[model samples]
Target: MSKRINSPDTEADITLRTYLDIYPHVCFNMIAGAGSGKTTSLIKALSHIVQNHGAKLKMRGQHVACITYTEIAAREIWDDVGNSPLIDVSTIHSFLWKIIRPFQKDIKDWVIERVGEKIKEREERINRSGTRATTKEKLRKEINKLNRQANAVEKVPFFNYGTGSSYDNGILGHDDIIKMAVSYLNSSEVLRKIIGQKYPYIFVDESQDTFPEIVEALSLVRITNGDRFCLGFFGDPMQKIYPSGIGDLPGDREWKIIKKPENFRCSKEVLDVINNIRRTGDGLEQTQGNKTVGSARIFVLPLVDEQQRTEYLRKVQEKCVSISDDQLWLADGHVKILVLVHRMAAKRLKFPKLFAAMNDNAPLSFKNGLTDGSAWPLAFFLKFVLPLATTKLKGDNTMVMRMLRAHSPRLNKEQLKGTEVRQALEQLKVGLDMLVKQLGDGSQSTVLDVLNTLKNTDMVKLDERLIRYMEGNAEETDELEDDEEGKEALSMQNFFAVPAVEFWGYLKYYNNQSPFATQQGVKGAQFDRVITILDDDEGKHAQFSYDKYFGLKELSTDDSKNVKEGKDYVIPRTRRLFYVSCSRAKKHLVVIYYTADVEKAIMNIKRMKIFPEEQIFKVEDLN
Candidate 1:
């Protein structure tokens, strides 16, 4: 049974189709609000292209490219499009890589240039920091490692994508692929023509978070190719979360901004709050597509300790159940409690110290790596060590052998009789045994111990970034405040041991497999009832101060200056995140604020007018 309504064409669908009817493609940006059937609209657009231009595209050997943000989203679009031969659906990374991967020589040159820039950055860091031998030694290895790769790029036969970088093997990392593609597209008119010819029409979902450089490059393609190539962006700028994204469309007079002002997901109450919060920024109001009843409020609380926070969460669930008249809100996994950081949920999951060690007050980029299994050490464990160790411990030799055969390097199945292949297989098994002995118990083994065993066994080749971190070198992120000194690498010894089983729970939370999710993680996700827990003290990042955002405290001196200069980042970003969190509720939304000044917060809540006075409640009332 399809949940999609067999409704008539929305003005957006009609407008887009009418434009598609034209000969030369007119690139336009669609402002699709949350729960507004953005994907449905995108799917319709894809179908329209196939129906209208399918024959011509097939004749020219061209295809419609649908670029999605997440692999999950890409798969959904792929399936939704019926796996059409004339249409290609892939993630932004995969899509860009596909178009640009053929230019091996260009890739080599780009990578070398990029690595040289990194080397320069590292040398400058060493010059700034004086006389720290351990740090200098680590930097030396990094410099050497990078120099080797840069010098070795030309000898590589062909570059590959989707895998982490191995300069020796010609595989590029995620950032490298995207950055190289963007760079090539910007620099080469010939490349742009080739891309436009190959992908006559391209649609990028979640375009708000697409890198600004990529957005501009695509816009250039659209402009240069003029009617030959059409590019469509389907996203809401108000929902943008990452600081690095292009929140708004390129300010070009030629580009059209098509507004999809419909909300089919949130109920009337939820819609009202979203519209109000949004009005403070761009002031685009959403018309509720569903006429269902719902509740939304800004719940106020004084700064709370761990125990109080636990009790408050329970009470909020109870409140949601009573208010929404849905008993399911109390049901496990039925409601969502979105915190501002992984550490908050990590505390509840009993890995607070481990999470805190790596993540507390860390830049968002660093935290993203650890939580999402992108950071090298974490990736090593989850991808290589854990699967083999667990299968061995369970005595699942079939699974173990299969994993070993699948992942062990230099295993050529066709040449199984060869001594080299046989030795590699035996070595992998030995390595797996050593790994299981060291960390299988999930106790007393430091991260460094597990890493060394994995590296020694060649279970998997560690990423260069991981090598740098292990060498007491942490990569700096964009969010590093200007005044702060360079961050110290997280202590490998003090960081929690690989309790693999417990780590799954943490990973699940990151993937939104658990009821507890971070606010940013649930960008395109919604639930029946949602409780967004916000605390300035607990968030610990200088970037997001919900207190300053909601007028509980004054904006920092720089924040005010940024606003005056029309370069404000904090307030607008906070507003966008707040809007995103609040908009994710179908029946109810409880935005809990742990603030120092309840009176001021309450007063500001009234001024904001996003919530009804009666709906807002204190923690004591929840009791």
Candidate 2:
């Protein structure tokens, strides 16, 4: 524990440490801005709790719960807290499930109630005027499905997460667990009391990204337990980029908002640019923690075709190299080129269909799950195919044999004759040959084609869900869906229909094997130099419009209406996103705007004063 955390130098009412010092009685939200030392403060707070109240909590069988956004983040906090048992660190889903897991009966009941509510909701929607027959039929099917689940849920032995959702098998979906947990916590006082008793002090990292209902439910626990439970949310409204997050937390008179105004990450110049970008939104000024200076520039270029755009990017890179006087600016994988969305990244890297499928209008949570290796086909490719392909290309048959021994079903059988062993090896060899033959030509094959190529081999076992999706949706796959769940399922169907090569590209960018990344995907990650592409036309998402936020484009009629009604989302969302992207640069930042009008866009940007005249560049037509 640092002395700064242990011995504070500020007023008790203003300092975050002082509030934790008044633990159990203190419940608040800590507004830690971009590059703010939020995690460091969190760790220090955990240490203070341990030093001050760890023994008492241990005696009472209670612990401090820190629910983070990702598993990687959880692990980092866990490692920082010395893997302390007193501090329970886990991802949001894991933590929610852990609290709600023991109440199987409640989960079952809640799920049934949830199904009833959905059925009623859909019925009401169908009752509305102008209901189409096709929509009516789809809603009827969804209602029928929910009815079946309501009946079956009562007999379900137990529910499980991180597995395929099955009405018969009692497996729950990712969103369901969160919904179920929050609903139960809201409705059941006993569950809230149990949670408060188990974890007396709960701190949610990236709380802005947490569902508003979860935050509210935790607040319920605090209210129920009174001073016995302390709840703190650590995140910045400016950093809330996810679609489902509680953008700006609703005003709570009970909770004190602690602002950490100093950024411990970015240098002065880089920090100044972000602070300016945030001024129009939150108006929260940030002071640099370090004395180091940085550089920032914005380049405006006329809209061009793919080939010309590529050349323009190269010229911009050359300019970045000149300004920084560092050859590393031109190096691949050294500078992250952040785009507006996955489609932009996919277009840049040559994977249109896969990216589009992933961006389908379903739960963003599921798409996130695919990258977390929860999706079997994706997981199989990363774990089995990529490694085996690399080894086969290297002519390392020994590694192939090793992977075969581990995964090959035929080779695992005992008391097999030499002939049978040879036969198994021959089958695997043939399978590998087929896979290699398809992939070796650098062809972008569909996942279905790859699955078909490997389906006969015993070594390349497929998940039943993947198989079912492939076979089940083969018919009627092109029909549009009216139901939300139907839409999500169709996304998977469309994904499987896309080229396997697109998935390779998807994972390549996902794993940082490629230099281009989506702004939403690179949250909390810093680079020495960052190149952010702000092309709203390429973004293709209706939810966020960077052009409108940056004044390069006019707001739509509905947008202007929403602003007048005080229901606007575009400005706040885009502002937060742009702030996040610009703040990722440690020493240098470059923002390239691909606009329809060079002069008009440049004039609008100059008027905005996000960057001064010299720092902003106007590129000639890249014809």
Candidate 3:
């Protein structure tokens, strides 16, 4: 039942096999490029262990712990394990939560007692007696704004009930899961023995992106558990796209590093381009064969001022249309576009225009109870707002009911006035309390069904023609799929039409907006095509030195510094940033520039050799 496929006859295969041969007792690193079947190899290795070594291993019912960065990636790996009899895979965070949940009371008590004094101080500062409403509002707004800003920049919300303030606290986010696990291993020899007896093998995927903390944790496990556990770390340093990625190869005691120099996801031409960028004196050769099925071209755009940036965006839209008509169109119409700004200033300036363009072209459409924007807001609300509201309402069901009534037209105009809203909200509160109590007693589903049946009596369908005209002629479809248990978790009908409490949960907990405000928000995410609009300011050049502006102070040294100081300092970073942006496009790259700055951008483009001089264009020349 293993879903793993055999490795193809290539350098990648040879490299993977070498690691598996020495695995279990030994630690080996397989640095394979993106789309190089690293996950496939891990699955195959796990299958081998399960089928051949399960009895010999006698792993005390311990499952293979496969750690990944995202929930989506973890699910993908779980699928790859494919109904395997022996293997167990999960995200590191989920795995830690499972292990720690048993000791939750002790852990919670310890953390709360330790951090109690700090929390008390903060609460007292804001909730002083006789405080003016304006003062309280200002403080609350400040707290909310700071929390939002932190979420945007760090992808970490202000509060983590598990670890306190994520901002001031030095707690690791996802990576800390492994760190905590390692701490448990070190603290309890019995726990280590239990884990060692249960799961004999550990596979860490995407090792290149792993942090030093995770690496250290794994090392501790190996040292403490002796030879009972086997570790396999797989990743490619060249594909270390994350800023804090630990690109170290395996070395020294109990560690072996193996190179996987294969170009399976790109054609020879594409490999050539990749090699040129990665070329150092290291003599790392690019492997050919297993070529990708498409062609790739890099482009550069010149923008002398804001006017030029606008025109460039227009050109990008035109290119998207062309690419859609020709090649690289997907069923979902999700184009992976990357707009790389060279400096912090450029990102600040250009990102707004870029976002506006995307919004103008693809206005966000949300479910009725959800926020008007994307799903991310709903996810946030579910995580923070729902619990707080539930606690405040004190078993009242009226919160959700009032929202439903507001949207419903069952009541007459006068009846829909202020007092009615308040009374209806009160009813909703009571109803929610009853629903929660019934659910706690295992009658919640029955109550939910009864409530839905009653609410449907007043349901009315509005004319679709007007909605279509106002929101564009887009087809409506259910967003959630039916699970095997037949439990309706989320549905378009309930989510889009019914203003239920469940809908609020869907909006608050499922939103996936980009964490950063500008281009950084879209980092690590890909689009089909990209259009970049450069700001027409002195700071525009800073976009090229992303490391400097984005707090990568370590990388923004020497040459990057000189580039910032020199007259043409901006050109190199700008051109490089543009290349990074354009390279993110899977199919097409379009550049737009002002008629005046066309020559300057073209000269930089020619110098960088992104495209031939003939391809460079001016605004007037386009027609």
Q: Which of 1 and 2 is ahead in TM-score? A: 2
Query: Cα lDDT of all candidates, in order?
Result: 0.76, 0.78, 0.46
- Can you give the TM-score per candidate against the true fold? 0.85, 0.91, 0.56
Model 3, span 1-623: residue lDDT tens:
54345455455555555555553467667665433456776777676666666666554566666777556667777776675656667655566656654554444343334334334443565688886676555444444433443344343222232211223232323333454555665677776666666666788877766766667666666677776777778775555544445655546565666666665545444455445544421345657655444434433344355465545555555554464465433223444333333223223332232222222222122221122232332333344334434554564445444544444444446666778766655655454455444323233243134234324333222233223322423221111121100111122223223223433323322343221112333323444444443333433433344323222233445556765665224333333343334334333444433223445455654664444465455554433
Residue-by-residue lDDT tens digits, candidate 1, 1-623: 12232355688988988887777667788998888888888888888888788999999999998989877788887777778999899888888888887777778888788778878877877788573776666666667767876778868888887334556568776767777888888888998888888988989999999998888888888867888888889999998988878898766666677899999999999999999999988888889898888888778999878898888878877877676678887888878888887777787776665575456554333455665666444666667666677779899988987776676554556746657777877887787777776764455665667677667776666766566666654443212232011222433324434443455555565556678887887887888789898898988867788987887777888988888898746789888988888888997888899999898889888888989999889876786
CA RMSD, predictions in order = 4.8, 3.2, 14.4
Error of 3 at 407 (Å): 16
Model 2, runs deviating above 4 Å: 1-14, 115-155, 362-365, 370-373, 414-418, 473-480, 621-623
lDDT for residue 117 in candidate 1, whole number 0-100? 83
In model 3, how many backbone clashes occur? Answer: 34
Q: On a 0 to 100 scale, what is the lDDT of residue 476 in model 2?
A: 35
What is the TM-score (0 to 1) of candidate 1? 0.85
Q: Which stretches of candidate 1 lie above 4 Å from their native place?
A: 1-8, 119-143, 162-164, 322-325, 352-380, 383-442, 447-502
